[model samples]
Target: MNPLKRLASQTAVYGVSSVLGRFLNYLLVPFLTYTFAPAEYGVVAEFYAYMGFLAVLLAFGLETGYFRFRAGGEWRPETVYGTVFSFLVLVNALCFLAFLLWSQPLAALLRHAEHPEYIGWCAAILALDSIGALAFARLRAEERAGYFATIKLIEIGANVGLTIFFIYVARQAHEADPGSLLGRLWDPDIGIGYVFIANLAASALKLLLLTPQFVSGLGAFDTGLFKRLIRYSLPMVVIGMAGIVNEMLDRAALKYLLPHDDATNMAQLGIYSACYKLSILMSLFIQAFRYAGEPFFFSYAKRHDAGRTYAVVLNWFVLCCVFLFLLVTLYIDVFQYFVGADYRSGLDVVPVLLLANLLLGVYVNLSIWYKLTDRTLMGAGVSLIGSAITIGLLFWWVPVHGYMGAAWAHLVCYGTMVVLSYALGRRYYPVPYDVWRVLGHIAFGIGLYLASRWLVTEQGWHWLVAGTVCMAAFLVVVGWEAWRLRRGASAIPGV
Candidate 1:
């Protein structure tokens, strides 16, 4: 099989679970938005955003460390797995204990003191997810995409089923008839608390499904080797923490930057979060790309012409991202139904955030340079710098401009990181990337987007016509470039 095709097959399998799973999970957004008020759903959004960051901490970047060491090839797979498994078990146990002890205080800090169970539920979810990190990492290392997909799909399916049972079927039944299914499970006083319970149940389901992988990895505990792996994975604690903080600090900041009223602030945050769901498509693509790209990068690092291959991969990434951005922006008129009517007011952030994510996807691709070169510290430095910029902008701009400021902050921060990574990459591990052609594609995409934006505003098929034209232009350019590269016509010398 062609290498790219093989990679695509793996990506599609993973995407089945990752992309479709996320899409299914996103089904909750509309469901929750309509079921609960925007402010109520906003609580779910904020808590889960924090969960995303916490999952990073609990996993501590061990997945990346797994890929690196697995590629290093100095030990048996069992030894590597054993080492990682033992350490993570100990660490996650400690974390769970800490969270259990501190859940009430943490909830108080987040101003959810009356609902301390929310913190406990999220903490449990994080711990479970962290424990499964090695199992998931093992699947990726072994290229067991099919198994990985199956496990993830099952987990997502279970979550969706339970959520529906809790939120839709149960709640509606209780409302319509007191003797219905929801009445049995419903506690009217708990209100939206069942949302967290459903999530907790689903997480425990993931733990059960992961049990086999966990057992298989622990043939014997290699204390010495475990210590070595810990040393290597420990730095990731800082890096992952910093990276997650970068992603979630905005939410933290936004809470304060907005008014003191919980209802008002959460309403705005709800809008922002729902608009963020619009960009989840981009996030899905970036995630699937990372799954495929990370292993591909490590496996092919020793290839004589890997640098050229990296350039090719990056160019293709830019092209695909631009295509996704255009498609989403153009058809957003229809996609707004994903959120509730009240939330559509924030739809303007969709385009800005999508573009920012496109830039971020590029940054993710470019960042592999540092990883492959074993200059992971460079990544830490770059992310820290980007986080600083994002935090500064969040404080400086969010209060004045509201959600729009958050959108621009994401764009500026991600854009700066992309440029910074490119600059530093050139110095340490220069690849002949096609800077001009990539920039041209971006510029062309911006122009086409602007034109479509203007032309689509009129009545009767204007959007359809404008969108079709823009899409065709994008595909034609991509096709032409693909052909040129295949023919070895180096229009941009190094490219």
Candidate 2:
């Protein structure tokens, strides 16, 4: 099979898991929005934002480091895995211990001082997830895409099931009487605390499921391997921090930046979070693409005309993202039902955020230039630039405009990073990415989407048909370009 075809197949298999997991997780939006007040949902959002930052710290960028060293072919696979795995175990242990020691102050700082258990439980979840990172990375490296997808879907399924049982069933049990199963296990007043518990349960289950990866083909721990992996992975920690900050600083800053009190801040954030979930379709593609693309890029970089090959792949990546963006935005009136009625107000942010996500997906695809060139510091620089832009905008705009400010902040931040990476990639590892053609596709897709929206209702099956046609038109243009490239390649036959 052609390399691209193989990648596409793997992406689809992985995407099955990704798309389904995201869809299942998306179900939580309506459930949470309907069950919890907006303020309560905001609490969920903030806690998850904290979880996001903690994941970066606990994993310590080892995922990217695994790809980097494993690609370099300098160490035994077992040796590298053992070293990194052991290090993560130590860090996770230390993280939990620190959280135990500081949960009081941390809760106070987070303004949930009475809910230190939230911090403690979340700390445990982060630790388990961090320790399990290598096992998942190994699955990716081994091309076990099916297993990877299965594990993800299983986790999502478990989380969703547990959440429903806890919130809907357990809450009712507690409400009717104190002497009940849910009342015994949970405090009825702790509205959003159950969300963390559900996640912890899910993470623990995922860890248990991945136990076979830990036990199989074990190797003795190596100190030399540890030092090397740390050396390579440490810069990525900085990059990961900046990257997470870029992605999350707006959400994190919103409470502080907004003029509203705690209740209103959360109310605004709840709306933002719920609407943001609608873009998970694009996020699913980006994630599945990353899982398949990282190794694909490393392998492709070894090809003689790797730069041209990368350019070709980049075009396809951008086209898919742009097409998905149009599809989501054009039929957003239908998609908004994914969240409950309370969140419908934030639908306006979807197009802005969807475009931002497209830029982010493009940036991820473009990042191989720095990775392959061993200029990973450029990644740190790129993330810092993006973070600065996002933070600046949040402080300046969010206070006045609320969620709309955040939407624009995401666009500005991701767009800056994408353009900067491309400009620098040209200087360091030039790839002939068809910049004009890619932008033209984006412009054309947007135009077709607008025309479709003007022609059809925003809800019902008719909306789906119109959005599908809009996306199909964009794909048709890309297919024509691909055919022309194929014909040109065919004509260059050797005598």
Candidate 3:
């Protein structure tokens, strides 16, 4: 099989799980948005941002390290897994212990004084997910795409089902009649905290399902390999954490930076976060690509035409993201039905976010150079540069423009990272990426979206008709490019 085709196949399998999971989780969006006010959902959003930040810490970059060292083939797979797994357990255990000891202070500090259980649940979810990260990474390393997809689907399915049960079945029932059996099980005091509880349950269930990997690595720990893994992977922690800073700092800053009172600010965040879900498709595809791309980049790095292959992969990636961008922006009204009317006010930010996610996906692809060349420190540097932009602009803009400012912060931050990563990628491990073509696709997508909006708003065309015309035009352009690229294709198996 063609290597690009093989990577695509792996990415498709990963996408099945990720895209489907996002779709399933989207069910929760309507459910939560319709049921609770934006202020309520904002709490869930903030806690998740916190979880993302902490998860980067707990994983300690070991997944990438495992892929790196394990690719050397000097260590047995079991021993490598054992080394990573044992280290994760130690890290997660200590972190969870700290959460348990001071969850009260932590909750109070975060202004959730009455619900320290939220902090504890968040900590546990982070721990379980960090370990599960390695288990899934192992599956990717072994090319166990079927197993990987299956477990992801199962975990997401469990989460969706439990959320429906807790929020729809029990809570609603209790609201109507508080003296019943299901009502007795429901706790109004917990309120939106059920979101955390459902996640905790889902994480626990997922860890339980991954018991095979957890149990298999128990006897093979190697102190020497472990230390080396730490040294190599620690920079990745900086990379990962800095990446989170670029990604989540906007949300974090929004809470404190907004000039409104807490409820109003939280309400604004809830609206922003809900609309952020509109970019879920773009983000999910990027995630699926990362899952497959990481191992593929490492394993294929030494091949003669590897650089061309990587370049072509980025081309396809940009086109896919462009299509998604147009798909969402051109037909945003249809997508708006996914959230409640109250949340609709912030839908304007979705296009900005979708474009930002496209740039983030590009950076994800460009990151291959750094990871492949063991220049992760440089990667961290690039990410911190983006983080600084994110912080500065977020502070400057969020208070004035509110959530739109955050949306622009994301766009600027990711756009800068893509440029920096590409520049650094050239200096370190040069790939012949089709830079002009990639930029053209993005420009074309955005232009089409703007044209479609004009048709709908200015010329008074029906939105559905305008969206259809715009989408068809974009598809025609993409198809032509695809055919032309194939006709001129000269990226053979070897130099």
Indicate which candidate wins on TM-score.
3
Error of 1 at 416 (Å): 1.1
lDDT of 1 by residue, 296-391 (tens): 888877876767777877777788788888888888877899889989999999989888888888888788777787777768888888888888
Question: Per-residue CA lDDT of candidate 2, range 1-495, in tens?
Answer: 666666788888888888899888888889889878777888888887888888998887888777777777887777777778877888899989999899999999989998999889989999998887789999998899989988989999999989888888887887787697676665766778888899899999999999999875465477876777777677777778877787777677777778988888888888888888888888899988988988788876777676766776777777788878887888787787888898889898888888888889889978887888878777788988888888888888898898899889899998899899999999998888888987886778778877787768554347777777777777788789778655543342220
Alpha carbon lDDT of residue 264, candidate 2? 86
Candidate 3 structure, TM-score to reference: 0.98
What are the per-residue Cα lDDT tens digits for candidate 3 across 1-495?
A: 677778989999999889998799889999999999999999999999998899999999999999998898888888999999988889899999999999999989988899999988999999999999999998999999999989888888888898889888898789899998888768989888888888888889888988897777676999999888988899999999988988887776678999999989999999999999999999999999999999999999988888878888888899999999988888888999999999999998999999999999999999998888888888889988888899999999999999999999999999999999899888889999989989999999989999998998899999999999999998898899887665544445631
Local accuracy by lDDT, each model:
0.80, 0.82, 0.90
Residue pairs with colliding backbones in model 1 are 170-182
TM-score of candidate 1 against the unseen true structure? 0.94
| Shift of residue 478 alpha carbon in model 1, Å | 1.9
Q: Candidate 2's C-alpha lDDT?
A: 0.82
Reference-based TM-score of each model: 0.94, 0.93, 0.98
